[model samples]
Target: MSVKIAVLGAGSWGTVLADLLANNGHEVRLWGNSAETAAEINDHHTNKHYLPDFKVSPKVVATLDLKSTLAGVQAILFVIPTAAMRIVAKQVAPILAETGAKPIIISATKGLEQNTHKRISQIIGDEFPAELAEGLVIFSGPSHAEDVATHDITSLTVASQNIGDAEWVQAIFMNDYFRLYTNDDMVGVELGGALKNVIAIGAGILHGLGYGDNTKAALITRGLAEISRLGIEMGANPLTFMGLSGIGDLIVTSTSVHSRNWRCGNALGQGQKLDDVLANMGQVVEGVGTAKAAHELAQQHHVEMPISESIYRVLYENANVQDEINKLMQRRGRREMDFQR
Candidate 1:
């Protein structure tokens, strides 16, 4: 069945996903805050700022009116940045209530709330109706918007507490080139997606510092370990870290040039100021904010996330990136196979 969906956020990922859904025969309405952006997408079928030289599906419509986007929609996908998620959700809740629409809420955005350190689903649950919040589905994995826009072989996980909801999402998104697997571990999936960006930034820093494959490999591996440690402490299944949202996400984000977080970290590693790097990138480097959340979460959970801590210091404290790296290297070493405990 063809489902009518609303994709919030006009960023690269949102545009790509809305286009994909349109191409899949679903009626998709992409909502953007900027009228100019909506006009460009509607008139030209191109989000030039985000996806230059890439054409969007003509079947997709862009809208500035949020209520219209929600009308008769079967599902809503939130791809906005974490910082803006609450504001958007607050604006959306009353509109949904007024319109009497109860679509399946899906969060593709990754990152914990700044001070509360709540996951994206928690943020949504805080603002939306109870039923929608309880059944919220998360879509995450190693797929990049740029690659997925080109119909590249991309696979992701759609996780929900409700298997029926996950299967519904999987069915809507699955195609020859785009594939999705269902997992019940929402905590693991969300953390895997959100936390990997921090590691990817570290990977970028290593790349920018002229480190080779061996260093990258070590960072990726150790990054997964710390992420898993914190994730496990938060009640997520340890094994979920080995799956698509976990190791799969960590590997791709930390290694790929398509990663904005990696690029942001690379710029920082090359000695660019955080503000300067973000201004030049023209996109939200999620890891920068996520690093702060990770730092706080580690402290809250009494978990030691050395790499994440270093990255956090570099991003937030104006600490010398090289000095932080040196500190990480000089840290006391321990057993590598201690996760099973």
Candidate 2:
């Protein structure tokens, strides 16, 4: 069955996803804040600023009008940055109420609110009514926009509180090149997606500092351990961290050049200032903000996350990257399998 979907965002990931849905025979309304991007997508079938070489499907309509974009749509997918998530959700709420539209909410954005430490789904739920928010779906995994643009095989997890909602999303997004699995552990799935960005920064730091495979392997291993520890303390399923959203996400984001977080961390590790690194990236490096939120969450829960803590200091406190790395190496060793703080 064909569905009318509103995709909110025009970044590389958003454009690619909109095109994918259009290719799958869905009517896609892509909304972005920039009129220039919207015009480019509609007139040229391209989003040169984000995905320079890729052509957007002409079937997808790009617009800056949120009200029109949501009009009669059955699903809305948010691919915006975490900082903008709440504001956008607030705007969408009144519009939905006016239209009486009960669309399925899907969040592809990954990051906890820096102030409240709430997940993306929680933020959306806080803005929208219970009826519209109850079945919200979270899309996450190791997939990257660059790879997906070229039709590289990509698998993702679509998790929801309601299993039926997740399966419905899986059906819409599944294709020969794009595969989605349904999981009901929304808490674990969101945390794994958000927290892995922080670990990826650490991985990029190691690479920027000229560390080899052995050191990178150790950091990734230890990073997953801390991520799992904090996640378990926050009411997430332990086994979920072992799946696609957890270890799989960490490995890809940390190692791939396509990751904005990894690239930002690489710039910082090379002694560039945070402001300069961010300005140059032209995209949001989610890890920079997620590191702070993860740090606060760890403190509140009394969880030991030394790697994330060190990353937080390095990014926010003007601490030297090498000095932080030294501190991590000098910390007291514990059992490899220990989850207790």
For 211-265, candidate 2 gives per-residue lDDT tens digits of 9999888888889999999999988999999999999899999999999998988
Clashes of each: 0, 0
Model 1: C-alpha RMSD to truth? 1.2
Highest TM-score scorer: 2
Residue 128 C-alpha lDDT in model 1:
93
Candidate 1 lDDT over residue span 314-338, tens digit each: 8888888889888988877778988
Q: Which regions of candidate 1 are displaced past 4 Å?
A: none
How far in Å is the alpha carbon of 147 misplaced in model 2?
A: 0.4
Q: lDDT: which candidate is best?
A: 2
Q: Against the unseen true structure, what C-alpha lDDT does each candidate score?
A: 0.91, 0.93
